[model samples]
Target chain A: MIEFTMPSLGADMESGTFVEWLVKPGDAVRRGQVVCVIETQKGAVEVEIWDEGVVERLVARPGDELPVGAVMAVLRGAAEPAGRADKPSPPAAERTPRASRPAKPQGGPPTTPAMPAAGRPRISPAARRRAVELGIDPATLVPSQPGAPLQLADVERAAAHPVAASTTRVAPSTSAEARKQAMREAIAAAMSRSNRDIPHYYLGTTLRLDAALDWLEAHNATRPLAERALLAALQLRAVALALRDVPALNGWYSEGAFLQAPDVRIAVATSLRGGGLVTPALRDVDQLSLPDLSGRLRDLLTRARGGQLRSSELSDATITVTNLGELGMESVFGVIYPPQVALVGFGRVVERPWVADGALVVARTVHASLAADHRATDGAVGARFLTRLAEYLEQPETLWKPES
Target chain B: METGKLNPGALRKILFDCIASVAPEADFEALRTDRPWREELEIDSFDFQNILIAVSKRLGIEVPESDYRKLATLDTFVRYLAERMGAAG
Candidate 1:
């Protein structure tokens, strides 16, 4: 039997809520078909199953949060025996409680609308949690079903309208505000852990960018709007290429040791339109052409803002790159997202005075900085990585046909 | 030929539409025209480039990278496009 499990997104993500399943039992599934949608800190991600089989059993409901590596479904091999397909699901260890729900009273999954058996209003655990986050008292909400247990939807519907009938001062924050608060708390927790655990070393450099700008101008002059690669994409490509020269800076440092990752995935720090930020990594940056990379970046941004990023894109970055340059910052010494050892930052390109071949001339340049964990790599390795990065930028034509 | 009849009113409508297309989540009714609309609306430079590209296509104008700074705000963009469009006529 093939077991479909909940895939972990980022280092911080512990579990994901199963929104819905695309395929049902007895359906023959092919490789790479999106089987389910999982809600994580990254937003609603369509999770794809890579194995091909006939689905036998679905283990979780819509509201259940499947923990990392938790078996979400069981699929039978096409050639296997038909009689064994009736076998029950695996033991209780795989069917863990949803992280949002409080600890269940009588162990095992809540097969029923089980509430605190002793309470008067017998509120469902999820409803009580939702009410707390929405700043509404669970007791204040009226259940839609008279005798049935109060569900999460009832609390949400009640929170939609102001609690004017009640006397408690409810926080004047909406669902969006609550979500924003949650995202901020998540970021704070990650960054705080990074500061407390990792010994960070910072390095800064100024690179003249006339050649890169000129190459970009020439490349984009005749191209259509969709094919144009922004400077952000170009910078990412350069970073991906530069990582080859210094592999130590391209992987995660965990458990007092640096673990090198094979593929060079660069996480981009993209800002959401509504609020908050998500660093979704582009897979295999070194393999993409400038135009292709830019197109992917464009698509990534649209999906990120639309809250439709896939589960595969949210996890497993070797490094993080931020372009505050686009935001018009002179330079930024950013915090490194944990597990990943380093963060590469680029500031806005501005025209500055420079001496070119013993003659003073005005040239456009940008400041790039690297914040790396000291345990992973020393300053010299980072300096070399920066030097290679600068070389790639200064001679921009090479980026189009970068050496493998 | 479609851009020959371009007026400030039409230009504003097109600008709003382009911005909307790039960032559909932006609250256009409360958006301020005089301020730097890109930052105000949280349209990053990449997405902002998308807006400019769409605008340039609709208006039949070629905006060089150098003049991107000159069109940061709605008033500045309308003024910049109007002058060039008049010169073309």
Candidate 2:
């Protein structure tokens, strides 16, 4: 039996409310299938199971609040025998509410057969108890809607002799305030942890954007508005390519060691519409073309705002990139999101006087800064990474033809 | 309504409307026509490209990439659009 636990979605996330379970007991689940949805302060994320198995039991029920690393479910691998499955798994105590024990059965081995051979209606523990209180068997209650699970209301309605008024909806304003508080706490914890643990070194450099801007303008002139690439995408590609040459700056520092990530996943810091920020990953960013990168960036921004991000996108970032240019800031030095060792920041592109080939000239420039974990790398390594990043930006044509 | 012969005020309104859509917080009336959009309005390249799209869509004229330099300022954009409309007509 494999234990499927609630994953730590990010450094800040400590606990989440179990919103819904997409699968029930006895269902054969494949690897990478979304098994449940958990609501966090950041948003609702569809959590996936990493192993193929038949769900033996759901340790935690919907609406239960669970801390990070709490076991959410138990699954029996396909190769496991069904005979020993009768042995009950331990109840998830952490998910239980403080005021009262849930109506669901807890402790000892499960009484009913876990994987019923016949089709059975899935009902919540509250619904089952309500059915019992009304002297009705829950199994006999047909779901109000086809394929819909029997909820507490269905059981209540069955007992109320068809005259049951719907329960008043809970006020969402309270939960909204609570969510905001939770988010503020989470950010505080994560940032505090980052500051306390990571010995950070800061480095900043200015890059002339003349070549990049020229190439972008020329490239965009030929394409439609939808296909035109954004300078943000170009900057991201340059950073990704630069990471290939300076691998030390492209991974996580954990357990007193630096582990380099296999792929370059750039975590983009996007501000949420509801007054917070989230950094979602753009997976395998080094391989994407400019247009593809732009499209992905757009999609990432949209999804981040809509609160539809996946668990992996939140957790799998190797390094982060934050661009304050849109806000017109000339420079930013960011705090490293722990586990991840480095953060790259971009500032506003502004016209400034420059000397080129012994002649004074006006040039557009952007300030780029790197904040890295000094424990994993020094100023020299970080400087090289920035230098390579500038080189890549200087030759924007190579970004289009990455292979060459 | 000859091709490219749009009224200057109407063209200015169209440009301001386009800018407003891209950067809603921008102060259109206070904008300096001689300054770069980035300097005057803090519009990034993406917003600039979107402005080009809006102009192309409203004016029904293609703003080629080579002519992006001509659309740098409000005055240059207005002149460029007027000239393009006249030439196309």
Candidate 3:
């Protein structure tokens, strides 16, 4: 009989859900056929069969969360004698609620394996417990030999024995440590390439936000209890509408040229409340109405705080917007998210001193800054784009009106 | 048990639900049985494993990773599993 254990789907995955099975017991399987689908931290994938066999039993079921390396099924040759129905069942001992485990005193050996005495390997119970904690398969821990009895000493010896220091390592570089290093390296490379290879230009402007702020306050006056921060929503909508006229800022430079996309995929840089940063994309922002944009922004913020966003939502942003208004900052020079050619920074909309028609005056104003990639864009182009965007922001009425 | 008895709709629903749970925002039609799961869902290595684990747990089946890397789509997943479990669909 061949034991079908939970395989590590990726370097970082420690456990997975048995979402569904494509096959049932007594089914004939051929080599290279997917027998089951497992849900890991990443996503869903179909797992295939190796040796042609008949699935002897079904082990896990939908919603069952099993640790990586746990045995979930058993496969035997087409004509092998059938084992008992409970043959592959995990021993009752393993079912002991984790809350009841005996506390270890100064790490004097680990807990025993949950399996019964009969099927237990020859290794010490303490070693079995330690192996479980380490997520190491005891069977695999012992060297593969025809009939050698496994022991704790053998496991310890194996642990002590290090790979030949001088021998060239032949294994693929995909271990957890290696993968983490690769991710960091990728981020570093992208940052350096963007900063060095992509010529960037910075432009700053301050615009009065009294009308927008007034609109937000009046709109929220009749809103539901849960509706607050309507001003940010309006600002985001304004920026989205502004991008429709400034199409050149809504794309990335790839393959030695700027690739203009049809819709503006704007990324909102949201800092999780006392947590990590997440940038969820609001696709085709130019098409969404003001109310729709407000609803989506609320939803995105909620999901970002709850840590519920999928992997795809976290990648591939053409442009990013960071609002420091909530943080009470007046202005900030934004750093460009890699592969994105531009980033917009917005500051608090506070009443500040200004001169109008050569007379000193106090007027409501919000500071804004735009960082553009100078590699594919020039000062003239950036100025024109910013000019069009500012015109939309200052007028505000024409932004919502559809072009006929 | 009789083989080839599982309804295609039932199986398809089960499969799609499993995928949607993991990637709620993914375009379902893009997750065609004809396309490889990775290409169809645009799943990376880590996400791929999580999906595999969910499939295994939900279906009461165990899929070895070495073998799973060979499957490309929904059809292959069913066909291979049918053969392995000694059933037909």
Candidate 4:
């Protein structure tokens, strides 16, 4: 049986409230299918299952709070025999309820309870807390079987049909506040951790935007509005193509080493309408054409603002690009998001006097800044990446050409 | 000069439709032709470019980057397109 657990969407996420289940018991689930929605600090994210199987049972119910790594459901593998359902597994020792778990000795920090014995139904700590909060006695709830222990789902079921009239429903507004607070805390923790751990190196370059803008204008002139590519899309394409020449800057810094990502997933930093930011990945950006990228970017931005971003988009980004241009900033020196080794920043494009080919000229220019993890890559590599990025932007027409 | 005469009302409708296509959520009825497109419609440079592209495609005229200044408002864009189409004919 494959146990589908609550995934840690980010480093700072500790626990999430089980908002709703999109799948049911005995439902056939394919890999990468969204089986549930969990309300996190960021928002409600549709969680996708990575394993293909027949769902044996859902261990958590709607409104049940669950911690990271807590098992949400169990799925019977496609190869598993259906006859196993009638056959009982070997008996094991009963699990000690959370309230009865032995306390640590004096002067010692309290320790977590020992892992439940094999064959026992696994219950999450958050679930136990939730049961207490709801005034539901876990002991009164029946387990799935004689050998199995009572789980959160059983407690939830009992709470729903309360024998006592004292049970209070958690107010939706209070939960929403809790979610926002959790998101703020998560962002704070992640940013703090990044500052504390990662050794960062910064680089900045001012590139003339005449070539890119000219190409975009010429390209758009020939096409309809729906088919025309945006400047952001073109900039993203340039960055993605530049990563091909300098692959060292396109990956994560993990385990004290730089692990290059297999594909380029450029995470575009999009500001949320609710006063926060999210950098969701545009997968395999190097392979997508300008028009395709433009469409995807528009869709991604719309969904992000509506709080409908998928779980994978949040976690799968290898590098992040923050454009403060729209906000009218001339330049930005950004803090590198941890795990990801590099971040690229773009300031507003403005007209300025330029000295090109020994002649004074007026040209549109944008400041491109890079913040890279020093532990993963040095100044030379970062410089090379920026240089390649500039080259790609200068020769913007080449970006739309078919990849050789 | 045998292509066709530029119709202001027809050109205006086409421009409005193009802008609507780029920004589906925008309230076209409330949009002010005298005000700046960005201020009135909350559109970015890319969106503005798309609007220009739409006008170009429908009229079969090339609106170069240098002519972008003339696309600031509905009046300016309509006049620009009409003059360009007339010149082309």
Top candidate when judged by TM-score against the true structure: 1
In terms of DockQ, which candidate is stronger, 2 or 4?
2
lDDT of 2 by residue, A1-404 (tens): 77888877765566877755667888899876777767676566767777778998888765678998788988887887655433322233211111100011111111122121234467765564454345454455667887887898888777775334332222222244555666677677778888899999999999999999999888777777767777889889999999999999887787798988777888887654335677887876788877777888877765665555766677777788999777678999999888888999999888999989999999999999999999999999999999999998988887768464
Off by over 4 Å in 4: A81-180, B1-89
- Of candidates 2 and 1, the better by lDDT: 2
lDDT of 4 by residue, A1-404 (tens): 77888766676667767755556677898866777767667665667777778888889766667998788888897888654432212112101000000000111111111121122233444454355456443444555555454566666776877764233333342343444565567677777877898888999999999999988888777775566667888788888988888999887777677878777888887754334677777876788877778789878775665555666666767788988776667998777766788889998888999999999999999999999989989999999999989888888878878662
Which is better, 1 or 4, measured by TM-score? 1
State each candidate's chain A TM-score: 0.75, 0.76, 0.55, 0.76
lDDT of 3 by residue, A289-343 (tens): 6667667777766554443343234444567788865566788667676566788
Per-residue lDDT, model 4, residue A133, is 55
Sort the predicted structures by lDDT, highest score first.
2, 1, 4, 3
Give candidate 2 misplaced runs (Cα > 4 Å): A24-28, A79-175, A402-404, B1-89
Clashing pairs in 1: A325-A348
Interface RMSD of each: 2.3, 3.4, 20.1, 4.2
Worst 10 residues of 4 chain A by lDDT: A94-103
Which is the better candidate, 3 or 4, if ranked by DockQ? 4
Point out where model 3 deviates above 4 Å: A1-190, A357-359, A402-404, B1-89
The prediction achieving the highest lDDT against the true structure is 2
Give the DockQ (C-alpha) for candidate 4. Answer: 0.17
